[model samples]
Target chain A: MCLSIPAKIISIEGENALVSISGMRMNASLSLLSNAKPGDFVLIHSGFSIEIIDREEAEKTLEIVRHIRPIK
Target chain B: MYPFEQYHSKALCQALVDQIHLMADRPLRFMEVCGGHTMAVRKYGIPSLLPDSIMLLSGPGCPVCVTSSLFIDQAIHLAAYDRMTICTFGDLLRVQGTNGSLEKAKTEGKDIRVVLSGLDALEIARQQPEKKIVLLGIGFETTAPTTAATILTARKEKISNFFVLSAHKLMPPAMEAIISEGIPINGYICPGHVTTITGIAMYKKIVENFGIGCVVSGFEPLDLLQTILMLVRQVKANQPKVEIQYSRAVKPEGNPKAMAIIEEVFETVDEWWRGLGILKASGLKPRDSFQDFDASEVFSLPVYEISEPEACICGDILKGLKKPQDCMLYGKNCTPDNPVGACMVSSEGSCQTHYNYAGIN
Candidate 1:
């Protein structure tokens, strides 16, 4: 099983985008999801945007990370 | 549904546990040689799921973990310049050397900047001509070509302020060193990102020379489990081979254009890894034509001698001789907040993996 976090696309480029999650902005890819736009939530994997995650799933993941408190 | 959530389909983890159970009698030792694999394996509690007889070992797959002390010292030297802007990835900022970390220097009012890519560093140099912009180039083959491309772009655009302190390393050479040193690795879960660039065919020589079963696996749990299963099959059949499970991203012949760009700008040379010692032809050096972009030569700094923290087992950890918990100062003395060792500092490091997910006790 894989744990992919959902992040909102804050901005876009040709094949990449700047995504935000829990107020942290990181470079994410938009190659896999052509329909993804700003305000869309995407599942980021190894710096690549894998899929467009639903808002509910994104909220659940945020809850889990908040509970787990991963990273320092 | 995600494979882990399926009722009828057993979790890939459970399948892996079952395989480990079957192979427990033989005392199998499989090494996942990617930092991402190390994190995933520990994050999902893969070790606890398996039988004790089947030991999962980690290797020197972490590019940040494998980078030598001298490289860090060079970075510190470059950052000391009055008008220098040293740009690097976030991970390198925390890796502690003899004196201190790049972050510590930055905190002490150095102009060390954390950048995501060489492109970012190039942009900084392009924008500011009065300041010398030096990018601390770190990573294996997967990241080298990108940096190489940036260097070529700098030359084309005639950006004199841009330079790079290259610490780029290759993987297969290090793998060969580990095997030759008798690390007792029965099988290997190869790095998917490196394989995506080098391809499964690049590992053909290793399998032939060492008779080790290898499978190129993705970063996900299913990908790891499938690769493990494939390794088990190879061992059971008495046929050591290399297999590719991440076909979606990797091809036999990887991106030739990227390889060409790398060849155009850099040359393979002898290099030192943090724990692996000096490995021949395992490092990238800027081509003779690109000498103007070489930071080390331009600065004329003396050979830097950096010492490690006493009681830190980062060297052993990188060599697969010990785990993060096995280190005397893993969670207690060295931590993500105040890292005493390099492994704890880098996100794609074994000690960081343990500290982040496996330090439940």
Candidate 2:
């Protein structure tokens, strides 16, 4: 149970890619990754890029995803 | 520096379980409205962690689960046409129609394509100008904005070859339906993705009318636990409120730009749901401005009231009226290999989630 986050593509490996979400780096599968380039934001889910996240909206969602728990 | 190590942290999970136990002077019924939450709760054993004081039931959160038989049949019809390219997300492909499914149509040499996004369908239309590209546009608020954006772009480019069979739905109305029916739901763990766009404000009416606690949670073990804790706290206090436990992605006010785009291209209309009948003004249809992209205008589907196949208790499973095991044909007659209904076929389905994660022995 995880929310799909819009992350930046820092680099790509064969069919896999490295994405940066809120300065934290993670790897996601590119099985559904298409029409996407290095600068594009994508809604990655379960080790795959399902859809390209809108940049402005992605940034906003990141703001929320980065801090999901109540501010303690 | 921000302090959480893992997303939906383990500390949150334990704390949530502890809180639920604290409120367990008696048994409580809680419903997780998103199918993703159902899978997470089972995967993390959230239900088992409780001291029999809390009961979590899966709701009709899976869009594929709620999509009526008519929509599936229409998709098969479009796929049967030689010049029609029916593009859809993966979940809908194997969903059975009256006679067959899109997967069956594809096997029969129909042009059925699986797309990751609505834009992928748009790209197909751009590439195959000679063929009519029909996208099975299904989902709640989260996916609707993308579909709306695709239509906006298509209309701007005058892509007459592109059309969408919109089965898109809204979430809040469904939540209301559950409470209104008085299905013995004490609280709600709202859908994270849908609230990301529509915001937690959508559940205001539920809190006001039914006096049930609504916590919007992410699809994670810890997220589910924390949300359950939130619900328990509200229950203990005897206060009905809406809170954002998945605060990382949702706010009181949702994505304005996405809302604007959706409002621009689509309007709420009375639509049919599978388990729940026609929910008045609960579905999204293309606005008059984008009438060209409305598949209903271009194609005429025969009115067919197809009967649901025998022993498929998907409807009961969806409404929280029954569990997957309660069905006469849960694992015996209807496994994933041979799905008698949509719930088994769709990966996000409650029955499939329960079959996979929940100890259904």
Candidate 3:
């Protein structure tokens, strides 16, 4: 039941927002987020934006992941 | 390849396994309470990657798998009524109720639709204005907010006939249920998406009370390996605390907006689970004002004691007290095609996960 995906918000309308994952656009409720404006990356669960992921933290995690060296 | 594939690199996974081996002083038991995580662990063959000393247990995370018989019977009863259509998630179709399963009812002529989300039920209601559309709302915090939103939508649009048979649940109480049973779980790989809605800090009380290390983890292969290594290190250090391994999605302070939305439509109440008995304040009930949307109040049915399938040990399996292999029905009579238990019905369920990935073990 905890399945979620990170989607970028493209538009905001009252308590709902439009987000794009890959190329598909879906409407998500913003009742759980106060500042997930357009262009922000938010973690979406069951048609609701639950968390606004920090860009710097996401980059840092990605950087660390890119540096992964296989154990021989 | 997907960007996340780097974490699945054989070298990276091997390195993480080596790190866990180095940090571990003795055998450790870890429980993953989310069905998604259970799927990830099995999909990646994570158990085989680790030392046999590290045992991973699956907990009561799947909503369909953990749904109580009473709730299912009520849903079945609601679906059987004339001029009513029952909408539910795909996983709930095969779950057994008192008479049988919704699938059986569907084959016997019932309007049971597998909806992608709660809002889809609203759409169904919009199309079939003549029928009563009862959405079988069942899930955890991750899903309650969606139902709450649908309730607001239904109220605003005056979408009559669109009612919710809410059997939603909470996760922390189930964790407490397992802990209270003295299951001896050393650490937890908390559900990734659940923590996003609830935040990583909510598990602090669990750590404080039980002294078990809890870390909110993402579902990626690297995320799982990283969190498992963190748990092993915590176990080695004897420092049990709640940590956030999936910080990118989870915040220390969870989304207040979502919780507020949920409160607008529902309230916490004592709920009964499939394996676990009635847990206090573990389920959601529609507010008194919204009783029109409650199926229990809408449908009148006789109450009787619930009896599970004779030989299934799903209760013990859900509590981590026994593995799927421990059940005599695991593969013999309990195949996924014709499931005798809830655990075998859901893809995220422990029994199904084990049976699909690491068969017989």
DockQ of each: 0.06, 0.10, 0.47
The residue pairs that clash in candidate 1, if any, are none
lDDT digits (tens) for residues B1-361 of candidate 2: 1223354456545555665576567778888777677777777777788887678888888888888878889888777676999998888888887888888989989999998777788889999899999999898887787788788879888899999999999887888888788799889989887777777777888999889889988666766776777787788889989988766556567766668888999999998777788899999999887889998767887766856878788888888999989988888888777778888887768778778876355
Per-residue lDDT for A1-72 in model 3, tens only?
Answer: 667877888999998898998778898878767887898888777677778877766556656655645444
Decide which is better by DockQ, 1 or 3.
3
Best by DockQ: 3
Q: Candidate 2 residues A10-32, lDDT tens each?
A: 78887568988878888765544
Which of the CAPRI classes, incorrect, acceptable, medium or high, describes model 2? Answer: incorrect
Q: For model 1, what is the error of residue B139's alpha carbon versus the real structure, in angstroms, after optimal superposition?
A: 0.5
Tens-digit lDDT track for model 1 on B1-361?
A: 2222221224434655566467556668899878878888887676776666667888888877877677877888878887999998887888876788888889989999987767789889999999999998877767777678788889999999999899898888988888998889889888876765566777888899999988887665656665776787788888999887655445566656657778999999999887788899999989889989999778876687757789988888887898888887878878888778888887768888888887724
Q: Local distance difference test, per candidate?
A: 0.76, 0.77, 0.84
Native contacts, share recovered per candidate:
0.00, 0.02, 0.53
Score candidate 1 by TM-score against the native.
0.82
Return model 2's CA RMSD, one decimal: 5.9
Q: For candidate 3, list the clashing residue pairs, or say none.
A: A32-B258, A70-B11, A71-B11
Q: Model 2, residue B239: displacement in angstroms?
A: 1.1
Poorly placed runs, candidate 2 (over 4 Å): A1-3, A9-72, B1-5, B8-12
